[model samples]
Target chain A: MNWLGLVPFAIFSLLFLLLPTFNIVLGAFRTQQGAATLDNVMNLAQPRIAIAFWVSIKLSFASALIGCLLGFILATTVALGGLPRWLRQSTLTFSGVASNFAGVPLSFAFIATLGRVGILTIVIREVFGINLYGLGFNLLSFWGLVLVYLYFQIPLMILIITPALDGLRREWREAAEILGATGFQYWRRVALPILWPPTLGTMALLFANSFGAIATAVALTGSQLSIAPIVLFNQIRGDVLQDPQLGYAIAFGMIVITGITNLIYIVMRVRSERWLK
Target chain B: MKSARLWSYLIFLTGVMYFIIPLIGMFEFSLRKRRGEYSFDAYTSVLTDAQFQQTFLYSLLMALVAIVFGILLVVPTAYWVRLRLPKMRPVVEFVTLLPLVIPPVVIAFGYIRLFNTSSVLPFLGSQFGTDVLLSCGYVVLALPYMYRAVDTGLRAIDILTLTEAAQGLGANWPAIIFRVIFPNVLVAVLSGAFLTFAIVIGEYVISALLDRPAFGPYLVWIGSNKAYEPSALAVMTFAVTWGCMALIQVVTRFSKHTRTSI
Candidate 1:
């Protein structure tokens, strides 16, 4: 058999994933004239990089947490047959559409819907005499980006949470009821514990997902923000660093962060499988 | 108990509002006539706009290219890995998937530096070349979903035995992989293709980065000008995507029914 064809696939995967990273790591460790140096990485250890890194972590955590919880509530409501089948299906479909929706067009949709000159903002100001700008609803701020991310993030939560709810085992709920447990008691004593691990896992995936995403920040907030991938994108195109090497360095940093987050996700997923089994 | 049921009904109503209200707003904004009553003028104007029409075609063409290549490439990778490389499974698994956890913007940046002028590859020297390079990036971007579907489908079939049987008949690996093994994973490929189509058709990051005049950039154009046309475009985009989603559902149901009957 021609097992050698397999070699091409193996090599292609390795090279595609490796070479870009290689260019970056190599660039970051090189002199201005291309001699070996550690200055780039060392400079990254400076206070500015640290602050940006910490900020990204905190913001990603906040958005992912809120999104996961929102997703959980919505998913449980639907999965418990809180809605009829047709409605549930449509909502699920809409959730899929919204969750997949991101980038500039998504930002535009939100801006048109909620921006300063946006329809809702105009209507709210006209009908209720509520100044949204006074209320700080600008679509060009850190919080504004978070608000737009919520559009998709909540739907992602539903996608992950609905499956877990399906596996909730209705018999367990019935058994709890038979034992004279209240609904909250039944959920607390039985359901939440079973769902906790995957819920945690799903939330982590969402965190990593929104964290790595740069387009939302790009379209909504631009480089006035300090998000890592946004910074990296600017380094590449904006050339604020004024050197292609800086672009490689930023790409290298993004890869490392995404790699680490993905590792955590893999571990969590493994744990979830174990818990379920 | 009756009150709890009523509470559930209320929750359902809220859910409907949550999903439908945004769409309703998009529709009202799209259909309203500035000079008169409701009209189809905005949509007709959007469809007739040459750039919009071209971008729509360009996006459909990009999606079709990725969908075809994704099916051809991912199916074999998923199949060959399942049959021959069970020991190296997780590594192969993670390799195809590293794209997902890595943000698209990061990858888009990677493309710029990796493919920009004066890079190792001459292909990145121009915008057209960069656009195709962007397509390569799209293939990678869609890899996680496509690979996952194929991997799951491979697990559902006993491919090793089939490979052995084909080998015993003096069939070579390519013949077996292409003819016998490929047909078995059709459903997975179909589902993955639909997903790839949905993703690539509406893709904005790679297109925006590579500075291609695809549907996403066109949408941004319409958004800045004819407000109602942009809303109409959004509704159309939503319809197309939802249609693909419905295709996935139908394919899954058809596959499920087939498995049950067989």
Candidate 2:
């Protein structure tokens, strides 16, 4: 009787979530006439698809690395830096909002700030006499995308890692201080050992977050950038690659990469929870 | 101590600047429609556009449907898992988190292929069916947050005691779930609902691929077509997202206060 209660939820998931994903995974393995083949997955290694994956990986890595470092500093400042309570509260509230503020609107905001004739660009040109376009800064480039992604990426990192930072017991730091340890030594030996797991886990999450992101990329640079999501988006829109199976292969590859990163995050989170507990 | 504090404040200030400058630029650019002086022409144009109004309302309706559906699906499962199916917690959790692992584009792509006209179910055969499919997709995208929120809420309240007490009063399963557990976790459900609204309102991949007239695709369309209007839409979108988050905070704080008072 109790098990019967899960029937509706189970059926909903099976029909909507699990089945669609299963269909994609299954299609990635099958051919046009439904014969099993490895050709689609093999085509993932082709130059264009491979380059898209490479660029996506690089962007995800760069943004995640920078987001983690900057987010850690900001979170640490609030959690341990003796900042006023109101600042910490506002920072957290802002992060909660900013982390969710992605997709097309975020890209538009970035373009407004950094694009040609943008406010900051014009200000820089007028005040400093250095033209951003003349300086070879384009908001549609790879680094430009990374800078835009950082808007949400950093906030997500802060939201995820702040609790872990708060979990750093004051007793441990005081004990380290009393035992002839400098502040630097305390962090290096004690805090770093405990914090590394969550930090790395958050980096993995951020990596997956940006890797799976398509809205900002598509809305910002259009087809000018051939990141994996944009390539996938184009493929979905008009079958630019002329092979639907290859599209499935792209989606499959994304799942594999993000799946691995999220797995790492789950494992690291579990390990860190053990210590924090 | 002073130096450390100074360094912390400096880092905080830098982070704030990084986050705030884009918003300031977006607002400033949104006001640049008239060229010679700042004005609200961009915002007025976007706000008055029929497509904008239609798409925003469409997305708003879709968000409401998704939230109601998500609550129905998640709250019950989370409640049952806590009360009876404790052994299935890990499986339930993994299923909930699968959305985070699978990208929205992939999910939308899969929906296109799996539910096409030729498929057995054929959810994409008609506009109504596609709308249903899109709403379900939104629910899937939001499953992680909704499940976590409801699960956290369930954890906070004593599910076992509540169920037993309701049963002792001769309450049926549906009544117990709706009357007993649902009221208890309303705050969590509201938080999840606001987050869902935030996500669904600005969603791009699913609605775009499904050919829905949601605000996300509209924003992207305007962005590609115009300049100042995109910034205006961005500012408005940011306000909506901020409002959602702020409402979640307000709801949570109000619930905490009420609970304490009780």
Candidate 1 on A103-194: residue-level lDDT in tens?
A: 65566566657767666777889999999999766878767777778777888989877877887777888899999999889988898888
Fnat for each predicted structure, in order: 0.28, 0.85
lDDT of 2 by residue, A63-149 (tens): 999999999988999888989999998998999999999999999998999899788999999999999899899999889999999
* Cα TM-score of candidate 1: 0.89
**Model 1 CA lDDT for position A62:** 81
Q: What is the lDDT of residue B11 in candidate 1?
A: 70
lDDT of 2 by residue, B1-262 (tens): 8998999889889888899999999999999999799999998999899999999999999999999999999998999888888999999999999999999989999899889999898999999999999999999999999999988888888888988999999999899999999998899889999999999999999999999999998988899999899999999989999999999888888889435111
Clashes of each: 0, 0
Clashing pairs in 2: none
The alpha-carbon deviation from the true structure for residue A234 of candidate 1, after best TM-score superposition, in angstroms, is: 2.1
lDDT of each: 0.73, 0.91
